[model samples]
Target: MHFSIPETEVRSDENGSTYVAYNIHVNGVLHCRVRYSQLLGLHEQILSDLYTFFVYEVRKVTKLFYFLPVVRQDPILGSSEMFNSFLRKAQQETQQIPTEEVQLEIYLFSGQKVKVNILTSDQTEDVLEAVASKLDLPDELVGYFSLFLVQERGDGGCTYVRKLQEFELPYVSITSLHSPNYRIVLRKSYWDTAYDSDVMDDRVGLNLLYAQTVSDIERGWILVNKEQHRQLKSLQEKGSKKEFIRLAQTLKYYGYIKFDPCITDFPEKGCHVIVGAGNNELNFHVKLPSDQMKEGSFKVTRMRCWRVTSSVPVANGTANPSSSSKCDVKLELAFEYLMSKDRLQWVTITSPQAIMMSICLQSMVDELMVKKSGGSIKKKKRLNGSFQRSDSQQAVKSPPLLVGAEVFTKLSSVSLRGLSSSNSASDISGNDFHGNYAFEGIGDDDL
Candidate 1:
């Protein structure tokens, strides 16, 4: 419930009208942004209520019956008709108020969904438990699964937007995006591939994993040859969920999260690349200008540090440009990679989803840290009794949201920054960069 307005920016709409946008962060993570007009109108509504309350108190104390014959005029309402209309439209879209209960359709990696009723005040953990209870997922195994906001692409692939934080309200987070392409998807959360066996031991978990693996194959996320594909098909036909998953795990990009084709400065500049993150590494398939493809991977253990930066375009001396004026604001992500004992290399990638990629990398590092520290796996307490498995059902489909394409059209340019040891070694060694554990226990041969 804690909130903070950490940053504010003056932004302009397509009509050239300027407005101050306040970025609202809840529990340290960016939640939503609101315009000045919207906040002003909301403030007016609160003031109106206070005015009514004070008037009633005064009338009671004074017993002002003598003023009853006088015509009383109500306070004038605020002139934010646009804000008022926005509130009304939001209510209509959600079909419920803050206090009312809403049904959230939580999707599994298998593309099946389970409907759970919750209030707007419910947190991510609450919804996860509700979905788990419906699926009859064991409490012990629950820790292995988490909810993610994934964008289903038009081509059947999915881009993971983020793992919903425990403090985040899933319904509000998803709805606030104002895009139908996003959904709350349940997926395995651990980074170590060794944990897959633990999940496969459970019937419900086995089926969920099986369904997701098959879906990945069908969507071409997992690469396989003719012989491997034929073998997998035979196991799948035999209803061998365990064997299927075990085999699929050996394939390329099995547990990796694949991103849409983006531009990266790896191997060559302006190379069209497809990136996947998993197993504590980033696998890249770059297509050169000559139509040749090159493959490369970057291990998290070799990274010294990484960051995501956003820059706005400014024209001449003006920080904000006119609506018709076009300027590029680059959204870039860069990471420092260890090449040798004393040598380092910086890799940069430009994409609208750079933020998500950064998050995935950080998550991988965190998972490894926990594993290396031998920390106990965090699990939620379970409810008594097991429930029946829900039938596999197709999720409600909608047109994919072209968020990246829209961003490119709105922004002027995009580029990433690189760091050299001679220029940034001190800064990297300081608190600014925390990935110093690159050489701790993992060696070059291990990577």
Candidate 2:
């Protein structure tokens, strides 16, 4: 995420205690208010996660040189302590691949290799077709084979296989961590029964995919061992039968649990914000005891920037009774939000329970951004007859930051054509094709 620190304002509470409030802009929009301490905490968490991801990625590379006995015996290359230092050089070499062309090696089921030259913009389908044509495979049998990206892990094994989506294309630059030239295996698809079953099972990496999905909710990579999984199963079994069914269904369909702290609001009571991804967009709802409400949502891809801020409450006189100051320390979000209809507006979120909600949404958006940019960039054009407005009258960019009802006006102006309402608490977790990954109950919002 792109971020910048803006001017600071010193805010004082009723007791005259003051703190410096830092204004941060995310994606060129005022996103939120945060103090120094909160920034430090968030930074620490982010750094820890990055460190782990980097280490895991680097460990995968070390496996490539494992068989070179002479290289291991060399003092500079052999020492475990020097792995971190060599990781930098390895990454640099990977990134140095020529920009115009990429070399790909296809590993066949019979332990054969075929090298191909292709442009970075080439689609995955082209590779499959090329391979099939070379092998003289009939059209009927073509579907039996699938291409897989062989990614290594921190465990010193090439067990991670990322299945390429039909729509996916190779990255244009080798500098990207996901550059396609690293490794590609043109083996029989899961339908093929002739290959080594053990190697095929390892290539699927269903456990790793589930772990990654769970990390999205848990906000960190957690190695849930067999014992912990058993405990979770036991707890679900002892509780409501419906809960157990739901848990089993979630594991079967989505391959992850819905126990995110931000999703549940953990220890905090009262009404809280609910956020989820749907149809290339972010949807939010507020759940209360009496009623459920739609807080409105913005397109995940259009958010140009964001910032966070915090509220400092001062002690008030007992008789005056400012309980809000004592119980509700709000975390505000300021962001440049892009509406589905191409309208742009500045958004600020100040709900006390929704402070961490921004972080959760941010993570989902990062993934969406990657997928959206993976292929060709599609430029959407306005229809000729819709609303009948002239091209000159249309807005090329969103106006300056708008707050309050105006923000809602810009957001609601966009049509909600295929949007549907479902009971998230009761519905069984499934593939998120409809974009409702989280529960949506309605409640009133002070915003």
| Top candidate by lDDT | 1
Give one digit per residue, the lDDT tens place, for model 2 in 406-432: 322212111011111322212212211
Question: For model 1, where is the 10-residue window of minimal lDDT?
Answer: 392-401
- TM per candidate comes to 0.67, 0.27
- Candidate 1's C-alpha runs over 4 A off are 1-21, 25-30, 33-97, 317-329, 380-447
* Pairs clashing within candidate 1: 327-412, 328-412, 328-413
Model 2 residue runs over 4 Å out of place are 1-204, 210-271, 277-280, 288-290, 293-297, 314-329, 336-369, 372-447
| Model 2, C-alpha of 157: deviation from truth (Å) | 32
